[model samples]
Target: MTQTFDPPPPDVVLDPEREASLRTIGVISYALHAVVAIGALLPGVQASIVLLIVAVIVDLVKRDEAVGTWQATHFSWRLRSVLWCGILYVVTIPLWFLFVIPGWIAWCLISIWFLYRIVRGWLAMNDRRPMPR
Candidate 1:
């Protein structure tokens, strides 16, 4: 019997240049997130908010181009991570006024969560896999 093979679907195939560009963008974005995450985990190191803002802006502007691609999930994932972390930190602000220890604990937990997300997303990107929705 003769062997038969079928080509992958169009969506599963990506242009080489386009894929390279997307990967480059993903690397830059992940790098920015890692820096901020590292800073949050350290007591004295402070990552600039500007780095995050820049990352967000780059993601927003390039996200549309990544539509219909696996990289799209990464863009959304990073954005959602930032949004959720910001909201959680803001919501916990009252804890600072009421109890300093609780506030510190809450922030530490949030920071750990933020770092986890960054590391997970970065690893997924490096593996060339799509992030879970």
Candidate 2:
């Protein structure tokens, strides 16, 4: 005997009001990240670090919808990217002490790498692919 498979019913989609709320939350989260990035350029490293930390926490908390899950996973990928960037920063610090140009160049490269990773992760999340093993 052959078995037949039935398709699942469509899920109830959120209304426009709920969709707008979710988008607003996402915008706020992105704005917080922008503030954190800008803080790095200001004087007082300690204060800037604190602001960045707060921004990260706020971003995490604001992500409470379906988009939030994607944002959280993207954030994790970015965190890993930052860890790799940190290793590069450590190795280049001594070089920076000797000559600033090469160190700055390395920093820029690492930053670009981190941004690229984040963008790729975001795109993958939007595509809804299974995480790689």
Best lDDT among the predictions, by candidate number: 1
Q: Write candidate 2's Cα lDDT for 1-133 as tens digits.
A: 5533222135635567765664464445444444444343344532245544564575556544544232344444444554576688789898789998887787667656655654555455556432231
Q: What local lDDT score does residue 107 receive in model 1, on the 0 to 100 scale?
A: 93
Please report the TM-score between candidate 2 and the true structure: 0.50
Clashing pairs in 2: none
Computed on alpha carbons, the lDDT of every model, listed in order, comes to 0.89, 0.51
Candidate 2 deviant stretches above 4 angstroms: 1-52, 55-75, 130-133
How big is the positional error of residue 94 in model 2, measured in Å on the Cα after superposition?
1.1
- Tens digits of per-residue lDDT for model 1, 8-121: 347666899999999999999989988998898799999999999999999999998888788888898899999999999999999999999999999999989998998999
lDDT score of residue 35 within candidate 1: 94
Spell out the clash pairs found in candidate 1: none
TM-score of 1: 0.90
Cα error, residue 60 of model 2, in Å, equals 7.6
**Lowest-lDDT window of 10 residues in candidate 2?**
3-12
Against the true structure, what is every candidate's RMSD? 6.9, 8.6
